[model samples]
Target chain A: MKPPLWQSIGFYILVGVIVLQALFPFYYAILTSLEDGQALFEVNYLPRALNLANYQAMLSGGVFGKQILNSVFVATVVVILSLFLAVTAAYALSRIRFRGRGLLLLTVLSVSMFPQIAVLSGLFEVIRYFGLFNSLWSLVFSYMIFTLPFTVWVLTTFMRNLPIEIEEAAIMDGASSFTIIRRVFLPLMWPAMVTTGLLAFIHAWNEFLFALTFLSTDSQRTVPVAIALISGRSEFEIPWGNIMAASVIVTLPLVALVLVFQRKIVSGLTAGAVKG
Target chain B: MSKTVQKSRLSRSRTRSAWLFLAPMLLTLAIVAAWPLGRTIWFSFTDASLDLMGEARFVGFRNYLEYVAWGDGEGQYYGLLADARWWRSVWNTILFAVVSVSFETVFGLIIALVLNQQFRGRGLVRAAVLIPWAIPTIVSAKMWAWMLHDQFGIINDMLQTIGLIAEPIAWTASPDTAMVAVLMVDIWKTTPFMALLILAGLQMVPGDIYEAAKLDGVPPWRVFRKITLPLIMPAVLVAVVFRALDALRVFDIVYVLTPNTDATRTMSVFARENLFDYDKFAYGSAASTLLFLVIALITITFIMATRMDLEGKRS
Candidate 1:
């Protein structure tokens, strides 16, 4: 049952539109990044010149390079800490049947949905009390509020689906719960960990509010905040070229990771949302 | 009797270890989430300034609402309740959430249906759809801001070339078009997430039903309306609520794209402004408290409405 020629053509056109709409903005950003001075002022959709001056300027000037490193450090520490805590907690939540377990899971899930602004005043006080203001550690500490719950939820969902027979066999051999988790579940949980860790890393990398409020210094700012605060010397001359170049540099890694782990990302997202 | 005792001992040890495993996470949540949230609420009841938070005095409901009477028991009201801008921000947040989520759902469904088709380069198309979602929100906001630039923007250039308008519009600066520009960027970024969620739902629908409908000569539109839509409604509804809750707290895009515009100032922005910029820390805490209450009310209502199983037994 072949479709009619017109219908097939219409379908292909729809596909073309979807692909174009999805990819056009990033393409335009990349194009705009390569142009400088008069080239930027003129709107040319096509690639005209291959210039790396904007990238060079952004990397070599100001605190932009340090900001990129700040984002990397914050996101990396956040992912590692959240994954370690979430795995142990997920093992308990998924494997053990205890009283108030359902309520506990619900509490964790609700915490993730908290509006960041809601905690701003208090978290600010906490940061000041701990003397973490104007430091990257403030971001690492605050990001856990959003990252921890989803990691636990997704990993709990993933851990529950593992085979129970292996655990039962391990139990018969008189192995402790820690040993079973270490020897039995650790190897099998790598894919789930990777998926959740990547999502956590992305969340921490892209977080703007805490980064904006907690870190007042120019060098301590993350990439998102730094990009938002990027400005030229004069109000009239906004540095769009350097901004786009920095934007492209930070986004390329995330785009590559998403493309490569497309399947795992999809599964991880669905596991968190659709399953709930 | 010996077997029963052994079982009891094993179960006791399991429960103990479970608590041990959960202790670290629960403590972290208490320190980061629960304690901070409690202090935020507490600050709302006091006159805490940003610089002199320690010397703050308690003021019951003054930050939320206060009345000063000078003559004949008649005067103006002061506080968040009386401020028209606060109400406006609440309205803006709701409107942004409702409008953006609705557009994302519709566009998401269409893209999901298109991608669900058997095509030659389906993987490539799917990967392309993920691009917008993969880009950071602030980066996308900057990219769109550049493209929507009033003077040298490509959007204005293309619109002129297409004869859509006579004069170039200042998208982010102008009050009339600020919200529109924000919505455009938001829809572009979030539609992929909605589509992916719906795509997951679409995949769950068995193919045999579609085959059966095809054998019966059912029209494609009817098949979609009658079969496909109903089956995926649960997933779509869940996604909608999720996205709505997310949209209610929208800060990054609105902050980056249209700053200091009354037309697009969300509750989050308004709260943050008072917290730091306006030097009204207690008042800002009050605003933050209300925002949390709104989201919490919506979430509770949603959970009760759906009767979502907290325990993983049913699924």
Candidate 2:
């Protein structure tokens, strides 16, 4: 019943291509980061000698420590603000009979998809207006546009999918809709809230354009933007060692998160993709 | 617990709390997403630049006129839509999206099929595939950039060692190879995403259908073409549209990989240049608004197509 040789070959080839392609760059990055200073330019398929100098320097530089803090701070604040905003909006749309609920939902979703460029100027005005330019808070607030709409929409969808009986029972006890949402809906939708929060955190952590545009000071830059500029400054030769070291520093957290919560992360990403 | 006596205060409190719960979202939407976007559209019509906002005045369609597929400062250096650099970027973007998504889908389906089988090391392989999608875009882009370096890189060394090419290939540096390299990196990074989405769809498909097809001795290709594809068209469409919209606005990977070359520049990059680099805020807003329209059009078409499929199924 097994297929012939070609089938197995095709299967392995497909799988091999995927794994090799995905894993090779990371492996190469590691190899590059580890290559001895003397053999850094050695055009060998494998590193001639191992070197921990890059990692040593990167860690001692304190540049990475600040970047990590920036990433965490931005991601945390964005998630908190986004979830706080999205939950309320979702509740209002789900429970209350608003005249323009559908229109508002559509508007929020569509506006969220607008290119960052369109909002760049408007946001610049707002950011500079608030004197919040060149700080992590500016980027976090700007990320609300990116993170809030989807969180609200998805939370609303989750709320709608919940069992109606609990809310009905609460209302039958003469509890107001607001009371029902607070006590009944909030706890029930906690998983969706976590999922939404995780998604928002990852997006904010991964965001680069706003980070690059808004955060001008070296100390204020988030991980991605910091990593982008870490390799070279003006008139300086490109530093591959520092670049690899920084890449690993920034990338390791995400990889560790994926490894620890692979199932949950995958479920969240797939849910966002499938639903959208 | 009855609804008559104590209801007086409860209903009032409930209404007040509902409003309280709603205030944050309404305020955020108004202040952040809705207001910024609506203002962007209005700003697109004015002559606004980042450095000189005091000079900002209503220019009424001048920004749109500037985007009329020309390169002239006043009216563009006389070009047609087909040949306009920005429009060319759009075409290249579409080509990239179409090629990458189609390849990723085929490759993803094949991988999904293999992983779907009761094979050894399946869990490990699935986890391995998901790693790329898990990595942040900047990190992966930098990794690829280093790996594709003209000197001291493994990719060129391997290809040369294997006699694939006589010269070291510049993956992201050269204009000819830049887009291809980006396409490669994108395919590498996103195929898992396609696979994961399709795999979810595959799980929704009953095992019995394939069994029935097997019992009928239908050829594998035909079974796939007729049953698998049609059954999963909904999911495929969803993934494809998502990929397309995202691809249209591709920024970080290209930004990291290439230094804003014309051959590899995407619309998002172009818009970024206008807004940040050139300080042409109004013009940048116009270009990005156009990009949003393009994505919206594609989304609408996708929604319409899916609706058509659903209606056809119902009928």
Candidate 3:
């Protein structure tokens, strides 16, 4: 039997509220980014004006442009390194029968749970020892604390689900484990790769604590830190308009990825959680 | 050569290759994670300053004792324990985790239930819900801060216009409402995550079970309570554990939106302040170590309780 009219209406209302809650702040950010100086402080819910001054001001001067580039480069490098390491390790963990494999996987998971503050002091010493303080490499190295474990876990789950016959056939042809992984399994793993890579990229991109702690120079900071430390000329004023604009600029790419790869991302997320 | 000899050689080569494949990742993890974690524990016992030139000396458990002890009849506590702000932060962190995770789980269940229905534009709705999760935490914090601004924030304006309040309230500034404000932003940001995870669990409940329940004229709520909930409990537990761990260490949202205010300082913000801002390096290390231990204890307990397989197989 059909549900009553009020129940249907309630369901739709709930859906609408969820949509609004998810999108309103972001929608408002875009609107705020578009408003000029005087209009910036207005409490209007809708877009009041079309202005590019904040965006222009943010991009033109300061290290905002370089910071964006640094964020991109850092996240990209982390993804590549994480995926490479995760792939080889995932192959070994899933395919090879080995002792202590269970313990190894648990150790990897535990590493991901280490709070950045827990490692902050020691990592500071490590960075300084490597002469990477206040540099882009510091963020890259430290982010592995999070990104690597997640990638390995998700990729191992994906690898285990592949058919055994394929690997058996490859082995029958005298394919080494590496050769089988490269020629046989890698072809079937692109979707998993994309999902894992995108998640890693987002994690590295959104990471704030380490970025805040590791990089001190204005130009070397990533997007999150740069936006957090974005300020007005004097000590008294904070340039909210410029900060919103920078926030929008940094967030847009990730939003695009989420929208385009929504299905894969959901699967990737569930694969990581439900399986664990 | 005998067949067993060849088999052993092949198996040995596979083991060697497995180690080879794992070497780089393990080594990277060692240098980046293990070494620093060990050093952090060591530093917790020493008075190592953030300043590179400061003299380092072993202080034993003085730092840890100060973190948990009261002072000698002087109307004060010693160490981080003595600092009212530190206790406030610890309380705030626990409060934030319990309240925010509870909200996320409830709202997420609602959204997941709604999305689990057969509907048009379900895919689009799923993608739209991810927007909040997709936004960077700093950006989300900034966005909410602007919208929650007492003077010109849309939230205050809308609340007043709707006759919800008589006057504007300073959300992040005041001790009374600061934690509430942080919870609102966190729930908004993470509810989608909770929903998606629950939705995944919901999808795993086979349709035939629902059909069977319908055939027996079982009420929807009954079906949900008896069938859906039990089936989804594992996923829910996993989601809760992950979210709790994340929320317990929350630093960016509180730091960006409210700064150093005691109203919203978390353990992380508290510890980071000691480490970097106050130069109480050993003290901060102890605090950090304590935080790690709390989280590690929770994680270990959860793993052992659930008997979860790392292989992700259904066993």
Best by DockQ: 1
Displacement of the residue B23 alpha carbon in candidate 3, Å: 0.6
lDDT of 1 by residue, A1-276 (tens): 999999999999999999988998899999999999889899998999789999999999868889999999999999999998999999999998899999999999999889999999999999999999999999999999999999999999889988778799888888998898899999999999999999999889888999999999898899999999999889579989999999999999999998899999888888889997
In TM-score terms, which candidate is top? 1
Report RMSD (Å) for each prediction in the order shown.
0.9, 4.2, 2.2
Order of all candidates by lDDT, from best down to worst? 1, 3, 2
TM-score of each: 0.99, 0.89, 0.96
Error of 1 at B70 (Å): 1.5
In terms of docking quality, model 2 is: medium
Off by over 4 Å in 2: A1-13, A43-50, A176-179, A233-236, B1-20, B66-83, B304-315
- Residue-level lDDT tens digits of model 3 in B124-241: 8889998999899899999998888888889999889889999999898887888898999999999888998999999988999999999999999999899999999888989999
Query: Model 2 over residues B132-232: C-alpha lDDT tens digits?
Result: 88778888888888778887667898899999999999888889999988998898888988888888787778999999999999998999899988988
Error of 3 at B313 (Å): 6.4
Which of the two, 2 or 3, has more TM-score?
3
Enumerate the chain B TM-scores of all models.
0.98, 0.85, 0.94
Q: Chain A TM-score per candidate?
A: 0.98, 0.91, 0.96
**Residue-wise C-alpha lDDT for candidate 1, range B1-315, written one tens digit per residue:** 999999889888899999999999999998889999999999999999999988888999999999989789789899999999999999999999999999999999999999899989999899999989989999999999999999989999999999999999999999999999999999999999999999999999999999999999999999999999999999999999999999999999999999999999999999999999999999999999999999999999988898877788886
List where candidate 1 sits over 4 angstroms from the true fold.
Answer: none
* Candidate 2, residue B258: how far the Cα is off, in Å: 1.1
lDDT of 3 by residue, A56-108 (tens): 99999968999999999999999999998999999999988889898999999
